[model samples]
Target: MGAEQNWIPTEIGPADVGAEATPYGLIDHLQRLEDLTGLLTREKALVFRGFGVTPGELDKVFDLLLPNRLAYVHGNSPRTKVGQNLYTSTEYPQEFTISMHNEMSYAHQWPARLAFYCEVAAETGGATPVVDGVRWLAALDPEVREAFAGGVRYLQNLHDGYGFGKSWQQTFETDSREEVEAFLAGTEATWEWKKDGGLRVAQLRPATTRHPVTGTEVWFNQADQWHPAGLGDETAATLASIMPVEDLPQSVTLADGSPIPAEWVEQIRDRGLDEAVNVDWRPGDVLLIDNVLVGHGRRPFTGSRRVLVAMSD
Candidate 1:
């Protein structure tokens, strides 16, 4: 692809629009801009830099960037809710790199837009890498793509109060079993309450999806993230030694209950990362992305990195 077409995220700075390097100036520019959604769709991702927006001023910024911010319900990543419909971006270890995937692609429904704000930049090596989903799909091997043609099944085993992953209450953000059942009633999912006070939920989703506006087909599954083969050999082996595959915190398989090969899993993970463009963090910087068009992940870092995220449909 040409350079213009391959640019995953288009960056904007105060100087680019002749605005002051302040939050109010950024807000004024955003208010005056026409068709913000259309611009986001065309660019896939946008980085708002040199704004000097503080934590106290983030809500106002988010209100414009993410209209009708949604709660992080049914999320698998570890995060802390810090404000109304706002969360700390994945609390995964600082030493481990997260693989690229469209947010919540395995679910029946997902956010259409995501906004991230960097409150504190890491000391070294922490960058949010974004990949064009179209490029990611094109990078995958034909055999691997065909293997997922029929769709994939995602399995989650959430405990009542304590477990390897999240608890059922935490996953659904509710303490009521009736509420959880009500939510699941609307999805194409099956759930079973285990004798050990755990909940096993399974969902089947397509491997690829077309953008609602552009109609561009993109890779849109979390098979690599959910599969044991993508976890690194040491971690996978430790999990295997602890429990059987079925009882693992999370797992995935083909729609027909067939195994996805390890090589395919590795390819999916590697190719997406290989095609990604890293967005290095700076305190007060903000990023807005069309979640369907771009997949995001994190690189290993040192020191403290505090990035907050919010989403909207």
Candidate 2:
């Protein structure tokens, strides 16, 4: 995490590959690469800049980068689906920074790779910050890491059709209760239906995971994002004033259901952001990352910004 060891995404420009700065030329360059996946595993992240890739031409590029794109099922972020299995990056407010976390790391299964396309760059800020999971883990205090070694328990309270946060239908991207149950049946999660037409789900997941290819263990949980302490003090206080802790939209605790200290979550949130390297966006730039090896977040911004994301297993 030090300056000397800071890792940034490898940038591949048109000139780097000896190609024209156009979609067709970029496609040709990618087609000639023999081991794209292996290259990604070693680099952790690759940023394609100065290619002038347009929305109309994104399909071909995405097909080469993220084959077999996945739907954002069970995703917690608020995003608009704009194309086949493609979504606008989290619709969080532009004035507040989004802390780093691996996408869906709290779930039983998560994507192996993530691709982000910047369609409209913000006038200021709005850089996507990514952190190496290994460095992130190293940056945490030993006590904090030890506390999470027992794993973490995540709870979600999704309303039937209206309430705080997302509803079950929107969360699972389905209207059928039976289908939702069927999906949950395949995972080690437990759920209950509330009298108020809401659903409560509880899941126990490891705090860290190993990269399938490299066998590198890294910090891989969303405890900070889910914990009230991770929300700024003002937000956490406001939510506490309105409802009981258990009634919050989401909560996290130790796997044995023990409360995690507020200071620990604060440290977790701050350290990840501290160790991150930002990827500034430019219109038509695409970034691909090995999801398990890196965690990503968004910085607060001014002016309009539009970034699309897609994932593949």
Candidate 3:
């Protein structure tokens, strides 16, 4: 199915951005958009003018801005940075249309919501893209879909062996091997370690999860299960050595315990990349995206494309 053909009508208030004494004050004024969207239920996108508000004052609003308050918001400023580091991480800021995938899919824990704000529009490309995760979930194969419904069984390598960033241990507040081991011990999963000491083996989570809002189950495994320690680094390497990462025993049906084919799982990725909607950004444009219902990404780019992110509880 395509995007709901019926456009959810939205009323736009005055673009006049009033001065806010506190960051929350800006939210009070911004609340109108929240109310109009039924907490943003009506439409997936919105743009704000800032009513000629000063950039300095806007900074104050940013201080008060909460991830739950807005999924994404773009300011009028021409300069902003989206990711912390793009080059060493393979995470591009403004390159091409990003594949439609949920943020932090590799992490056992994920944010419920995501937001993007456009500070300035690029002269050429640079557009925010999105896909309806629910729509994709509904179209998945019955057998394969059932497997994902079983829940996601995944492991993330705490080490940045792939060169994404510092080791996962460094990124966390506490990265002690003992602490990590303790966290792994708390889960019910099968695991093993890699030949090298770089990664650990783990299987501490379910194979799929039920969406609290829509009650729909989607393929939660994106890229976490294929890592070295995520699926028993040795097991993953062995599987990768012999078979493609997609063909591994990543998902199983809860009802019959049947396995989901790798090809079927890839289809979900194909749908996300093919059916996603692109959001071309402009300066002073504020956009909110439903992380639970939507998946997003952007292609690599040349110039500086800055965007800020905040998570919703």
- TM for every model, in the order presented, reads 0.98, 0.98, 0.62
Regarding TM-score, does 2 or 3 come out ahead?
2
Instruction: For candidate 3, write residues 30-99 as lDDT tens digits.
Output: 6543453345543544444343333344444443333333222111111223332111112343543445
Q: Which candidate is the best by lDDT?
A: 2
Native-to-model Cα distance after best TM-score fit, residue 85 in candidate 3, in Å: 14
Clashes of each: 0, 0, 32
Question: Candidate 1: where are CA atoms >4 Å away?
Answer: 1-5
Steric clash count of candidate 3: 32
Every candidate's lDDT = 0.92, 0.93, 0.46
Q: For candidate 3, which ten residues in a row score worst on lDDT? A: 70-79
lDDT tens digits, residue span 1-313, model 2: 4432668899999999999899888899999989999999999999999999999999999999997899998888899999999999999999999999999999989999999999999999999999999999998999988989999999999999989999999999999989989988988999998999889999999999999998988899999999999988999999999998788889999999999999999998899999899999999999999999999999999999999999999
What candidate 2 gets wrong by more than 4 Å, as runs, is 1-4
lDDT of 2: 0.93
* Candidate 1: tens digits of C-alpha lDDT, residues 1-313: 4443457588999999999999998999898888999999989999999999999889989999988899888999999999989999999999999999999999899999999999999999999999998889989989888889999999999998977889999999999988999988898999998998889999999999999999988999999999888889988888889999888889999999998888899999999999999999999999999999899999999999999999999
